[model samples]
Target: MPDDEPALAAQRQHWERTFAARAGMFGSDASAPARAAALAFREAGLRTVLELGGGQGRDSVFLAASGFEVHALDYAQAGVAAIQRAAEAAGVARRLTAAQHDVREPLPAADGAFDACYAHMLFCMALTTRELLALSREVLRVLRPGGLCVYTVRNTSDPDFGRGVHRGEALYENQGFIVHFFDRAKVERLAAGYELLGVEEFEEGALPRRLFRVTLRMPLR
Candidate 1:
């Protein structure tokens, strides 16, 4: 809701079109990190999980198959619909719920509704540092005390910075969206309330993609 920054809106619109046109590329695949996250959730006794920016629910389907009650949220209408279709095809419709939710607004769920949360490639979509922090806080708010937050973001230290559009070092504000690069230290500082359990950086695929995978735990107290 709030009037989205125009540039941000444009970028989102671009993504919406891309997702709508290519829904097939968004579904479940066998990825090591995804499988690892699901296994971690199961071992930690997290039966209920909410996946923010769940895209087409590839991860959601995996989590549900792993026996977790999964709620997959995305802002794109087509993305949600694709997830729903995928769930039905997989025969896990009863265990998976796909809905349209703007993470910038209050999460459309009860407080402490889930045992854990997972966001793969969700935070990177945010264009601003403020938006990222706000989204992070909102994620914290919905999670139960001691619940885990596992997510990934592009690292500032990645050798490929500015390779996309050659944007300058200054904060790039497009429409209403803001995207700033972050290193491990910055992420740790922003995620203050949660204990930073681990950080892993790796390059994937032939595109030489850089990813920082992190696991954080909300304090039980």
Candidate 2:
């Protein structure tokens, strides 16, 4: 992709077509980690939230239904539109707002605009660590002081599973997108400002089919 080009539009189109073709795969329930993170915030007294890179607004819809006022951002137009439609259909449209925004740029919202923010499977797909750190800083910029930011990234130390596997040191590219790999230590260093609340790893299938999963939280100071 060129420097001025926005890859998100293509990405959004790809997912939109996929979801439309297989709506059954786009389950109404939130992902395991997203649900766990949201429940954690609820237990900690957070009702207002922001979701960055909230593709198709699955988690945003769920959070809004659970009584959270959600501002969901995605660079893909289709993804944002899908979220809007879904929110309307779910009758929580008033609780949710979806917009097209890039994480690489400064967020339009004011400082301390949200009590919490959540992202799922977003960071790992970046082409570089700098991109990931830039996105992380943007998340920190929009969050309230001492608020929480929760998200997941692939673990690097896991055996080379067939999923997202690359031939060499070059980052993995799928459908013209790049995904950077990281282990726990690198992620901790990248998210230095936030306290590392937790880290977990898991495998999906046997070696060549396994995926390493890590979840962590950072507190905005």
**TM-score (all chains, Cα) for each model:** 0.88, 0.80
For the record, the alpha-carbon RMSD of candidate 1 to the native fold, in angstroms, is 3.7
**Residue 184 of model 1: what lDDT?**
74
**What's the true lDDT of residue 128 in model 1?**
56
- Superposition TM-score, candidate 2 onto the true structure: 0.80
Segments in model 1 whose C-alpha atoms lie over 4 Å from true places: 1-4, 166-180
Q: Write down the RMSD of all candidates, one decimal each.
A: 3.7, 4.0
Q: Whole-model Cα lDDT per candidate?
A: 0.74, 0.68
Summarize candidate 2's per-residue lDDT along 1-221 as a digit string, tens digits: 23222443355466556655654344667866677777878987887788877777778898899888999988767778888988999999999999988777788788778888877766665435566677777777777877777776656654432235352332454555545556666677767777667676654333432233343444544
lDDT of 1 by residue, 60-151 (tens): 88888888899999888888898899899988999999898777778887777888888877777644556667777777788888888888
